[model samples]
Target: MIEIRNLTKSYGRKNALDGLTLSLGHGVTGLLGPNGAGKTTLLRCLATTLAYDSGRVEAFGLDPSQASQRTALRRRLGYLPQDPGSYPHFTAFDLVDYVAILKELTGREHRHREVRRVLAEVDLTDQARTKVRKLSGGMRQRLALAQALLGDPELLILDEPTVGLDPEQRMRFRALVSRLGESRTVILSTHQTEDVAALCERVVAMDRGRVVFDGTPGGLAATAAGQVWLSDKPPARSQLFWRTADGRYRTLGDRPPGAEPAEPGVEDGYLLLEVAA
Candidate 1:
């Protein structure tokens, strides 16, 4: 549903996206990267909000540069940017209702059904009348997600969606996303490896504005297959181990002669990429 070819973006002399080329088909795909990894830049381009200096980007076969085609693409695209905020005077219901109108500009009363359904879908029906300022952080995030789904969009691009959410809320949001992925393309950008492992059918790892890895969850796990391990004590080379709260450690590289195999996880694979970069 998303395609980027030789896309390049520059902020003065610094390059944010450098000749990046990748194609995304239908399903949930995680755009994984560290801070300033061009994940946002790429998403903005795909969202048709930010223009790139060079190269071509197409979303569902519609070129972003074409004004006539852009609106059609927008009709099918849903985006939940990080830190999406609501106006102080707008209630949760009001905010969602507004988005519903934009999704179907002339529907008026017909849009009300969409607005109500989305509010309940995100479990905000109880707080529908409350002003945005009164809702808790998690509620606002849910509201943002509700609006993203307001259009029954075929392609959803969410950036760092789970940030600031509590564990329970995060799980619920993940479940919602998983449900959406069953029929459409859901592209999410996040640095949290576990988030990708949880919901995405494929993971795309980027660093320094370039894609370094793009594959299935199992393929990602294989990156650190033999590199993750556990030890009775912290290894002398402590850089490889991630310290745990229970006085245990998860280390990378060949285990010491007597050390047994430790459980490999998303973070282990993540670290392998970090180390490689």
Candidate 2:
């Protein structure tokens, strides 16, 4: 579990996180936000990879601001950053093994077992021996995930973990994350609304560095209830209308005369929230 209160972080004059307060328990919670919405900043703060300008952050009853507690918190959490960076020369196994050691896996044989286990979990077993530079983008992303899964931490912070993944791999990741969430807390930050709809039990939307909405996936979709309508053509003067796959115009705004009310989904509500913000 994690708790935050009035957490604020800034980069010079820009506030990355502004008076953010949140509590997370065991389950998959999707963080939905557009660029510059502070999702990554919040995740980094939770991971203790970045320090905030103000407020408190505690995970599993330990304060991450303290040196000793920060170490302890790190031991109980796994983080996959937005840009995991490149390890060009290291093989997939080596990359994970390096991180496992950092996570304090001291025994060689045991560490190797863990490295292979995590690699397999990410479906990168076949490329375990391949060099990082030679792996495909998706394979490299999975390799980053392998390092994050090194110790089976209680909390997992994933920022754009599905980036570059094919549909099949994304489904595999959803299944794995869903299974993990049964016992621990997983905070998944992504732009992919479909993933949130499919995997997250709770959804949190942020805008301009603050929490805008927090609720269940269905509840999020319901935020757009009665606001979404379908028509053969977009409503004149409507700013939020898009062509759908069915050749109909799906518009989110005040209803147009004769337009049919369409069922709202997670993305529809999220978009409406963004526009309002």
Candidate 3:
């Protein structure tokens, strides 16, 4: 479990996280926000990889601001940054093994077994002997994920974990994350609204570095309930309108004449919140 209170982080004059407060427990929670909304800043603060200007962050009853507690928290934490850089020359097995060592998995035999287990978990067992430079973008992403899965971390912080993954790989990731959420805390930050709808029990939407909406996926969808409409033509004044596969324009805003009310989805609610913010 983790708790953040009045957290604020700044870069020069702009605040990345502005008086943000949140609490996270078991299961998967989807973090949704636009550019500059502070999702990465918040995750970095929680992962103990970045310091904040002000506020309190307590994870597993440990204060990350303190050196000793930060070290202790790192032992139980798994972090997949937005851009998890890769070593071009290291083999998949070697890369994961190297991370396992950093996590203090000292014994060679045990660490190697862990490395293999995580590699298989990410469905990269066949490519274990291949060099990172030879792997595709998706495989490299999976390799990053494999390293995060090492040590069976208690808290997993994943920022765009499905970035380069194809549909099938994304589905596999969903399954794995869904299974992981059964017992541990996983904070998944992503732009994919469908992923949130499919894998998250809780959805938190952010805007201008503050939480604009925090509730269940259904609850988020419900926020746009009566505002979504399907019409043959775009609404006159609607700012959020898009063509759906059904050959109708799905519009969000005031009702348009003869437009049928369509069921609102997570993406609809998220966009509505963005417009409101």
Candidate 4:
């Protein structure tokens, strides 16, 4: 449903997105990257919040750079930014209702009905009347999510949606996102490997402002297949080595003579990509 070609964006002397090209179809696609991997930059560009320096970006078969087309695309798109601003004095219900209006839900009865429905979807119906300042961080995140789901947009762009969520909250979010992807396209940009593994059918890994890997979760994991090994101690010559919870050292790179081959995971492949780049 989305197509990007040679996308380039810069900030001062640095290039945030360089020669990035990607195409997404129906279903959930996970965007995995490090802090400066241009994940947020790409999301903003797609949301039409930031303009790219060059390249073509098409959403639902229309170019977003054009004013009229951008407005039309926004009508069918839902965006949950990294930090969705809030008014502490506004209650959860009030905040979502305001956003509904911005989305052009004009009729009083219809807007109210949609606000309540989305609040319930995010499991915030009981806290509908609670002030934003009184809610927990996780609650606030869900409140933001409720606003994004207001119009039931065709394309959902979520950036770090699980940041403040607890384990249970994150699990609920995964289930909700998975369900949403059944009929529409969901683009999830996150640092959480497990989230991608559980909720996405396809994965895109980026580094240095460009996509380095685009494939299935298993295919990404296979990038590090025979490169990862486990041993009692950290391997001195390994490119990347870390101690696991089981008190063994999992190393990526040239295996030591006594190191046993260990199954590769999403994180392993991601780290390997970082090192390779």
lDDT, candidate 2, residue 222? 96
Residue range 203-250, candidate 3, lDDT tens digits = 999887899999999999999999999999878887789888978899
What would the TM-scores of all predictions be? Answer: 0.95, 0.98, 0.99, 0.98
For 1-277, candidate 1 gives per-residue lDDT tens digits of 6788999999988899999999988889998878888999998888888889999988777987999899889899899988796786899988888877777745777687788888887889999999999888888888998988877899999998887789888888889899999999999998778888899999999988899998987788888887877666878754777667777677888675456686677777877897888
- How far is 275's C-alpha from truth in model 3 (Å)? 0.2
Number of backbone clashes in candidate 4? 0
Cα-lDDT of candidate 1: 0.85
RMSD, each candidate, Å? 1.5, 0.8, 0.7, 1.0
- Candidate 4 structure, TM-score to reference: 0.98
- Give Cα-based local distance difference scores for all models: 0.85, 0.94, 0.95, 0.93
Alpha-carbon RMSD, candidate 1: 1.5
lDDT of 2: 0.94
Question: lDDT per residue, candidate 4, 1-277, as tens digits?
Answer: 8999999999998999999999998899999988999999999999999999999999988899999999999999999999999999999999999999999999999999999999998899999999999999999999999998989989999999999999998999999999999989899899999998898999999997999999999999999989999999778776588888999999998887689999999988998998888
| Candidate 1 residue pairs in backbone clash | none
* Candidate 2 C-alpha lDDT tens digits along 89-184: 999999899889989999999999999999999998898889999999999999988888889999999999999999999999999999999999
What's the distance in Å from true for residue 141, model 4? 0.7
